[model samples]
Target: MKNQSPIIEVAELFTISENPNLRIFDGRTGPNAKEEYLKKHLENSVFVDLNSDLAEIDNPKNGGRHPLPKFEDFIKTLGSLGIDKDSHVVIYDDKNGANAAARFWWMLRAVGQTNVQVLNGGLQFAENQNYPLSSGEDSYPETDYISGHQDWQLPQIWMDDVKLATQDSGSVIVDVRESQRYDGITELIDLIAGHIPNAKNFPFIDNLDDDGLFKSPELLKNLYSELFENYDQNKITFHCGSGVTACHSLLALDYAGFDIPNLYVGSWSEWSRNEV
Candidate 1:
């Protein structure tokens, strides 16, 4: 079943905590993410490592830092997490939904799993709301995740396609990295600074309010509709430093009731390495 929205509030999550088909995931990243989760996490939420579970990392020059895993491997990963096709999956990260949580949500949606959502405001909001938390690891009985789609169902673009789109006046490429990185001011992660040619800078943070939660759907619709009014959704592409945080904006667009756009998984990371 498709969720009413891609973003789920902590209050609503409380109501569905007891749903037999519900599965919660802690999709935090960083060197100490597992340690942090072991210290404290949403009750019964299984930890999903970004590097090992969500991405198939290799040479960044080829596939970026966080390329989507193979479909068969991903299905096995879902099963290992005890997530079946019918599971109502809720994912969260400490950095709001801009981290691996949104990536996981995007991956699930791409695989035709519609009952998944990112917890709005992420772990911080849930903690502030006094949602139940548990220490140490949590486990669930593994199941075979029967998936009908053998490939990713959502739209995605390769580096060559993005190059062609850049030449098209009607197409738009959105860079969701911070303004500093986009503007060549300072780049802490990638080797090169500055954004792709003709790409527009729209930091992923803009999708959130002062409270760190997503802006209302109506507000988001108005904001993005104007920016994307002239182009067809298929002609738009969203990307970030390594193709992870880009999903944050994609999730926002989905919440705003717009069709999801193309994700350039081999984003700036791969582009910078391959290009001069």
Candidate 2:
């Protein structure tokens, strides 16, 4: 297949209804994503459960909840999805690139797959665009998904480093949870809040609007001016409830053409469990 393809446009992804290269994956799982997707989804898109296929569970002793899958396991999942190394992966969810699409994107980058992108604003945007929808189980021929070299490029910083860097003037951390969650007003996930002490709060929702589509680059530029225009990109780290939504922020930053930084995948979920 010499012909290459980018992610499907919001219009085509829904309107055309079929694209082989544009693999629209339902990266929406939070105990309900699978059921909801089964009920309905963008036509021709495939479903991938985050919990089962994407995670390698960890023991309570190891402190990793939903640990990353082993290399072999990852290869298997890609194979089952009928994706090859060069597959142009486009993952989306009901939430604003939340759910687990960002995680799916991160996992793709972690393995050196560079063509992955999050469906900014996600499923709601598709519907808002008046894209067609279908509800049914679709199957595909099983392809021999070959494993390639592990090209781990995405970085992961630990809580210990983040703690020490709080005093480092040049370092910054961005908490991607909702504003109330960041302010400790809403304690949904972690017992402690106020966002890693001094990390800036930019809820993932800001990346999109009421319609669930991303704002224009100019608007995004002004919104992220303080963070992207002025600071060192590598000095930044992102975190959310469970390390999933944080990637949303990172993806937005990348879209804005700023330096993409490491993600603290342990996030608050794993961080709160630590002594720090």
Candidate 3:
């Protein structure tokens, strides 16, 4: 495995919790996320809200339901969490790394913070491994985080870019939603079911094993290699229902020693609303 792999095992995380530079974030998302955090979480793990901390929920149509937050606001958020450029951030969510945990990791990396990793197997896996859990909230002393970039460093495309890609044979748009959702057989979350035209279905769940943990790096490399054949990694775009789970695929790609592709942050939610 690569030394800079974006994943860290639960045992490794437990051992590093005592390090002064270590910062753990609980990235659980959804309606009852806050309440769940108040109930139980990893010791010393500060809760990071997906909607507020990680996203700007001004309008769903404008930038999907959970669009990336403003750059300055995110920098402040990092500061509030006592995270600087050198901080070692380890984020985890209840739903393995497939939920907001991966999104948080992506957001941190977008800001050029290199010392971040998503907890492999997430909170559930930690519990299975008998890792200790603590109840109630936690807080950390604020620090200064002076970000250099006004925007994300990683690749991301909007709906217009995706539309143009549909007509371009060189670009490959990947829809990371489930098969049922991709085939228009079911439209539960979004208003519509079918995927964007010319987009290939490579469900994000496929990146995980039956144990709900991500597959081995070698396995992921081979799997994505087969899926992407001759497609240029740079020309590839990844998206999920609203761009949350899409990060899971992106993380898997990075862990597999592949280049990180572009993300359509608005994803299906924004796409379904548009006439295109």
Candidate 4:
């Protein structure tokens, strides 16, 4: 089957609600994410917890707060979610796909799942569009999802690599946290403040518009093309707090038809703890 766009609109999802291969997920994160999901979510959507499902959390100094789970564990997770190779998966979160939604999308794409997509504009947009919603959990029969790749196919960089990239004039390291957090003015999440030595600040929220929807592909392409004009795609890396929001920018890049760049999953959480 031909791959679909990484972004899907509410109207299209509504039309395809009855597709037997469709599997919708609510990928929200926060202290009360599950509670919020249990209260209401897209109809027939199963809830996926960020800390438990998408990540293998341990010491922050080790691999940041939300490191990717082991590949085998993630495969089992996919199976438990009823996501087979052919499943048309759609994910959303309340944060306009900036939270765990994009992380889930990236993981699926990394595993060579071409039919997965993130719901454009996320839950609020769906609710505003009057897409059907349901309270409580929805269940589905599990499938043993067979992966095509032995590991993540997408580019990922560790702290040591990122450290080198920061000093390489040919490379660009982008920090996707808010400017204040990047500037060392304020930090509510990670223990430390400020950004990597030479990492450029490009908050992930900039990927959205006034309606909280992603900007036009042409516009995004133009915007990123200008910013990254001097560097090769392979030389660019993106990171954010705990490695979650960085995928939002990566998603934007993919939506803009650019090659997905390297992801620094340790991000600020691990960097701050390890570095000065």
Scored by CA lDDT, what does every candidate get?
0.94, 0.71, 0.91, 0.93
Supply the global lDDT for candidate 3: 0.91
Look at candidate 3 and tell me the lDDT of residue 94.
93
What ranking of all candidate models by lDDT puts the best one first?
A: 1, 4, 3, 2
User: Candidate 3's residue-wise lDDT over 80-185, tens digit each?
Assistant: 9889987899999998899899999999999989889999999989988888889899878899997788889999999989999999999899999999999999
lDDT of 2: 0.71
Q: Which regions in candidate 4 have their CA more than 4 angstroms from the true location?
A: none
Clash number for model 4? 0
For 171-221, candidate 2 gives per-residue lDDT tens digits of 888888888988778776565665676788888888876767666656766
lDDT of 1 at 33: 96
Candidate 2 segments exceeding 4 Å error: 1-8, 14-18, 59-66
In angstroms, the error of model 1 at 11 is 0.6
lDDT of 3 at 41: 92
Candidate 1 wrongly placed segments (more than 4 Å):
1-3
For candidate 1, write residues 102-212 as lDDT tens digits: 999999999889899999999999999999999999977899998898999999999999899889999999999999999999989989998888999989999999999
